[model samples]
Target chain A: MSIRIDQLPRDKFIMPGTAACPGCPLLIGLRQVMMALNGKMSLVIPAGCSSVIPGMSPATSYGVPTIHVPFASSPAVASGLVSAVRMRGNNGPVVVWAGDGASSDIGFAALSGAAARNEDLIYILADNEAYMNTGIQASGTTPWMAWTTTSPNGKTEERKEMALIMLMHKIPYVATASIAYPLDFIAKVRKASQIRGFKFIHLYAPCPPGLKFDDSYTVKIAQLAVETGIWVLWEYNQGKLTISPPSAMYKDKSKRKPLSEYMKLQGRFSKVGEDAMKIYEAKIDAYWNTILKLSELYK
Target chain B: MQETIQRQARKVLVGDHAVAEAVKLARTQVISAYPITPQTLIVERLAEMVDNKEINAKFIRVESEFAALASVYGASAGGARAFTATSSHGLFYMYEMLWWAAASRLPLVMAVVTRSLGPPWNIHDEHTDIMAIRDSGWIIGMAQNVQEALDMTLAAYKITEDSRVLLPVAVGLDGFILSHTAEVLEVPSQEVVDGWLPPRDPHIPYVIEPGGEPITMGNMVKSDAHHMLLKKMMDEAMDGAKNVIHDVFASYAKLTGRNNGDLIECVNCQNSDYVAVATGAWSGDIMKAVSDLREEGYNVGFLRIRFLRPFPEEAIMDVASRARGIIVFDRDYSTGLGGIIAAEMMGLVPQSVSFKGVIAGLAGVDVTPSEVKAAIKDFIDDAERNGPIRIRKTWLMQKMEGGKP
Candidate 1:
């Protein structure tokens, strides 16, 4: 199920040099998305790191047509774009590149509306846990015990189960991907582009600055997250839910890495106490249980 | 589009229905709206038309007023003529996106069923909602009656999509008064509107589409002057829109045999003693009041300020200069300031005119012709006797049990 680096497209849609910081996982994921779609999709982005990552005005890093919309209106905007594009008898896909804060919290209603309408567009939420663009504030999907600016002593609430919520929508596709697994995400994007419905991809992106990790360890942190079984990489296709290739071996609890190792690498979890860790671990276990249960759909 | 209906015909419809009729004629490709009071009927009718295939359009039932406007903004950017409808709270809900559309300079039209903002849940007519967007780089047109509501929808498309003025347009018709009330209006054939408003040129300026040179919008601009220049361009467009509105109105009138005036409709205000100014549903009553006052030997004339943005400043000034008195009837307020319309007129009208900005119909209570006539008579006498008087007062329908304390 894995493709070699040589199989990836040689022509890059995203030019080199952007406002993105070193070891930024968003650029990696965005690059993969553009490559997967062959840079033919119209992109709608709400306010997020991607908005600034496109470089400044007059010069854009993206080599594809893009639109910037209001913070909470990306999904609906994409729905509208698809409508207008198809009206002109063009079959090009309208893709929405949104962030966690936009998709899960502020833009939740619009996200739900687009899904309910089953709009023919792909919506990928690059979830970096918090509102990183706005100075690392707590977002709806900020993990339990994650110490964001607003959640001074670690978040008290459980992180929202957005992927599962999206899966419940029963759209043609719903996926959870990590930036560390570029081939996996690229594969999903290629698969989803062919499905004519609301396709949601919740990407597990690690932030270097926001999470206070070493800039070079961004991909390492994301990999640690998956190995700890905290960020499950899976996809719900048609009526079947299955664990993806990279994460296939890590499904067993015994094979998972130490949760402390993942938490210790990121400073966002610095304030996480023993009690908070217990709560966080419990939540992770519960998430895995549901994901594991759903994996038996086609077994 | 498949011609289901042909030829011009006279039909009596409510303001909401008239807007729906015009939208169908405009051949809007994409429609997105969320239901709100008074505004609901326009979308309801449009949805019915879409469902029945009377009009070929993609109607998206958005979740909120915010999303409703957002969809149209996206659709417009995606090279389609788009439309939406909302009311007071709904407009306010779309406040952020309104700036997005205005700044992006998307050419589109929206019908605002004018309604009072809610504190105690009032669904009646008021001008506060549309008035709040005066500075928001949108051409705001107020329709006095049902006919104007239908005509203005097409006119709005013409003005908004014009190469010179590529901005959003909001055609506001008063709630319950024009919105729910039925009246006779001429519904022109799609061919007529087609002749006036040519198909929207998808590449007038730009569009977000697939397989194009990658261009980013709404990114960081380093220069303050660059940001200010965008605002300046909007102002320049607004200033230039006066002629565009006039030409569009004249062209529309030439074809349809009905003209809802150019920018401001001068009703017998040519060298009259004083002009009574107002807009929306109340302006129709104000016109009646002017006639009533004239029959009563007052010789008062009416000036209905239709396009509130690209605010007919020169037109208002010219009329005010001719007469020594001008009383502005405002159905909307400005919080710490006086009536909204009156406040606008106070700055533009000549120093010679006895300008009185009167705040009336705050909560959409009936502002009848007789009440307006009485107020105008008093205003006329005050202007004649007191000469060049300037003041703002509320024409209260009620007061404390005892009298004005």
Candidate 2:
């Protein structure tokens, strides 16, 4: 997947002066995705921050056609849109831009069905850990020991492994990307755009207000997540698995940063004790071990 | 107007199958549905039809009713005629997408096999499911029998796809009673239907089309006035549906010699002393009761409330005001508020005319023609003996040993 930044289209699909907050990583990721599509994609966005980030009526931020559906029907809507587009002899890619809450909880059934059917769609699940648009409520994708309005004492359950779940569907393409690596994200989007079946990209996006971090630290937090091995960047294509750049380097735990170094930056994890940190570290290590086994099996 | 053509052969079909046949004739390009009791046969038959190339459509077997409707919404927005069907709990499950389809102004058609909502779990004839979504800004209609079920399903596409009324339409058929009971229905020729109801060309500016302008649909409206204005547009569209519905019905009648009036079907309402108002298949039973009472010098009339969403308020007012008393037989009950249809009628009917609500046939309980006749007799007797009866609601078919509230 050799691609240069200068080769990418210069037209800004996510127009300037949008309502997105300063340093919102999802916005940055969406802009890159739009650029990758080169304004040929039709977006189906469910109710979330992105639904509003496109501004209100009469003023849209998206340069491509968009349909904002209910919170739990993005993938289903995309399936129908793809079918209709094909019926009309238009085979353009149909994309679903949804959030963690919608993708992992409210819309899980729809996502699973689309994957099982291998519907022709590009589903991008932007994970900000919590339901940021609804004021930082704990979602299924929220990591363990993360404080949210619904999980004030910190979430007791482990975060949902959505990327692995997507792999279980055996779709044509399934990948995990981050806003911190724009090039990797763009390359994955370009790759997904070329595939013909259900493609899912689980994005690691950092929310400043929701995670109680300074706005400027959005990109830093996202980068640290990959660097610390807390968020792995990888792709699964045609039953083959390969880990991506920075996160791939952490397979040898000796090179991975301590979990506390990543947790200490966000106030949402301030209440995390040392013992909990050890448990989370062990869990992350176990996850990487499982990923390695999957890589071996798929290979 | 196209010239009237020779009618096609008639076939015996259940209400659910009739809806499927109509959908096939309507040339629905995309169909997505989950199987539920009573409504299952509709999707199953459609699926089989799609597989056999009987209907050139994509049948998506969705996981849930929410996705079923959402898939249709997406397909319709992408400039295709789309459809789905559900019953009772399935309709309730897809409640959110119901509003999504309507608010997005997607010209889609959904056939709802009306059934009783659950607690004890019963799948049979009841109107509660469709009635629950009457206020969801979609054009709603209730079919009297299998024939009307087929006709209404065909008319629904025409009504919903009208440039003036680009709202989703739900054609309600009674579960088990109409959905399962087979009746003779005139299945119009594909040529005639094709000539009458052409392919949908939605007037909405924002459709999912490749190479079209980048337009956003269903975006947030922060301003109260803007939000209210969108709602006002829905309201006005609904108001405009009255004419579209009438014209479509008239056009359908001209194409085939069958019409369920425009909105409300009146049976001998002229100079009648009392009128019995009902909907769904049971309206046939009410009409029978009206005829029996008229034979006994009761001078009774029957009005079938076809389109429930638009409410047919003016037509209802016109018919009910002329009658000395109006008896509304509701197949479903609204907890703490009596019957839903009766409640709506109370607001529309004249204050001077006597009105009574008879709640019956709940949980699939059979409201026999004899039972309907007896209820009408009671209402007529009350209106005759006691001028303008005070009892606004009566629970029919309830076994009460003593007087219990």
- Which candidate number would show the highest DockQ if scored against the true structure? 2
lDDT winner? 2
For model 2, residues B124-222, the per-residue Cα lDDT tens digits are 778888999988998899999999999999999998888798899999999989999999978889999999988877335348865557988888876
Model 1, TM vs. native = 0.97
Collision count for each candidate, in order: 0, 0
DockQ for every model, please: 0.77, 0.78
| TM-score of chain B in each prediction | 0.96, 0.96
- Give candidate 2's chain B TM-score: 0.96
Residues B1-405 of candidate 1: C-alpha lDDT, one tens digit per residue? 223223568798999999999999999999999999999999999999999999999999999999999999889988899999999999999999998899999898999988898798999888999999888888999999899999899899999998889989999999989999999877988776787778788876688887765777777776778889999999999999999999998887777677768889998887797888898887877888888778878878888888999989899878877887888889988899978888877887777778887887877887788888888888888888888788865654656587773
Off by over 4 Å in 1: A273-279, B1-7, B400-405
Worst 10 residues of 1 chain A by lDDT: A1-10
